[model samples]
Target: MPGQVTLELDPSLFGEREKRVAHSGKLVATAFRYKSGVAGLRVDNGAGTVTLLPFQGQQVWDAVFFGRSLTMKSMFDEPQPTRDYLRTYGALFLHCGGTSMGNPGPTDTHPLHGELPNLPHTDAQLVFGEDEAGAYLDLTGIARDAKAFHHDFVSRPRVRIREGATSLDMAVDVENRAGKPLPFLYLAHINFRPVDGAVLIDSVRDDRADATVRQPHLAQDEDEAVVAYHRAIAADPSSHRTLKAGVPIQPELVQTMKAAGAADGWTHALQRHPNGSGDFVSWRPDDLPYAVRWLTRGPDQDALGLVLPATAAPDGLAAATANRQIVWVAPGAAYRTSFRFGALDPAAANGLEATIKTIRGG
Candidate 1:
């Protein structure tokens, strides 16, 4: 018995942009026919919008602005790979890994699930969940082994919107619907493209890490010193038994956040300017702790989608847990977390500093 709302999208907004079925107004996922084989998501609550490029050789892609497109050929730099089922971006929710428990797979293979490696106990799922309302997905008979979809590969998720409003409120339910005791990791992979000067603001860390190079295998490079630091944290008994801090704001990354209406490089925090509308917000889940930051800046950056991952765990589940960065949940349990996205003109407003103070109640 949760309150719901619907999403409204203008097809004309992006010509040839195919629209997905709008359930109860919580989400409207759109696909561009003539563009980069990308899809965009519009949540009902003004929480902010996200875009995904399923064909851009990446698992996820995101952006704040709309209408901009990248060429498919320009993206992968090769002829069309398998146009068949390329697992681009969409909300990914499932128990993925190649292990049972106690032992986990390598960080690179963490997202891919199977048996044999005896991966760590990890569960990761992403779906719009309830704020102050109730649950979103009606988990009346969701079987743990049940295929996410009936016949169609894409999940036919359900949602509802009460009155016609510009915003949306939805629910996402996670339970131990599986028969066996399930161990897993959950995350909302909100991917964002890093435009030059695009400052990312989050307080998920107590101490700021100098901008680290993002390696393909892990969130950060495999520096001997960094690995040693992680090992030390893992050995600490006073920590939370996970590798996350959960601080949602950072000033150094902000210096790297790029401005809007740009073609390359990074943007400083989007201040309320004479011509700009500053809007940014995030969540502070008590369970998840570590936050991730990433940006792939290059001439073909647009062709290659980037991820400024704001995570609650560092690296993979095993590493994260070792560092005391895990969210423990009781069996047959349910919880909710939410954030807001709105305008805060930095020039006219208190700038990024004022906005952070407002969000943190500082």
Candidate 2:
């Protein structure tokens, strides 16, 4: 059980804005809404709309584009998409799998993905401002993961979205508030509904697994999941045997992957839309050296996830720590990282390669 604590909202720490502590009304700024077992917040940055669960890992539950939403509504049975059912029911709470992702074996009782996703967040504040670059909304939140007499860690997340920008930027600082050193594994789970013609592409070769788990062909409005394991460390995301097709996840069924061993030099990954539109995710490789791709392509509970991890793998605390893949923070030290997600629809006549190179500025 984690203890609760209050925190101050420091707009000044973010540095100078083009205007004063500029603010916007909820219509154009940020608003907090109530949802089942959690509090949902929406940020409308003029160019796009982002709805997230502030108390629940600040998970970005929905990304609305044009008129359709780009995220999955977890309950597969419901054909219609609505916020009420999503907030109250099981929606994708995408976040970093606590210290790991895999089964930690029987000795450890931690469930898949660790304690971070299910834990609640606290001390939240929303602010809007503009700089010379653009208008933006910023959400500041503080939360903790701890046991009654064990480790206590606090994470401060600064999420920003700019006006006229299709992407979201998140910078989080995590610290060990406890008295002893802490070992940790971290992975970001950003899930989106499968879009027609959407494919995953990356800059580096992947180190993939040898094991494969195939799924059944599902009809529209049906749900299923299977994972393909990568036993060897290869090149990057694109090289994994399961992803060699380089095609958008089949929209007809559910699919998932658990591959590890990331490579260097690549800073971003791209998901291209059939209409020539696409999404790009960029991060500091030093902070997030690894990544994972999960496509819950079930027509009923559709979600295409691009997981960027701060460790080598999402296996679990015991496995990662044992392999020296987990990062350790001293009692008085802090760990920090940031990543950006945005979309681009270049007018180029080039294919996926050209689209990818343009997004990454290669």
Off by over 4 Å in 1: 1-109, 112-171, 179-181, 204-279, 299-311, 340-353, 358-362
Task: Report the number of backbone clashes for model 1.
Answer: 72
Task: Write candidate 1's Cα lDDT for 255-308 as tens digits.
Answer: 111112112211222212233433333334332222333222223322111222
Candidate 2 residue spans exceeding 4 A from truth: 1-27, 30-37, 76-93, 99-103, 206-266, 348-362
Report the number of the highest-lDDT candidate.
2
Candidates' lDDT values, in order? 0.29, 0.54
TM-score of 1: 0.45
Instruction: Count steric clashes of candidate 2.
Output: 14
Q: Residues 30-80, candidate 2: write the lDDT tens digits.
A: 343342223445656666677766566666667775555666657632112
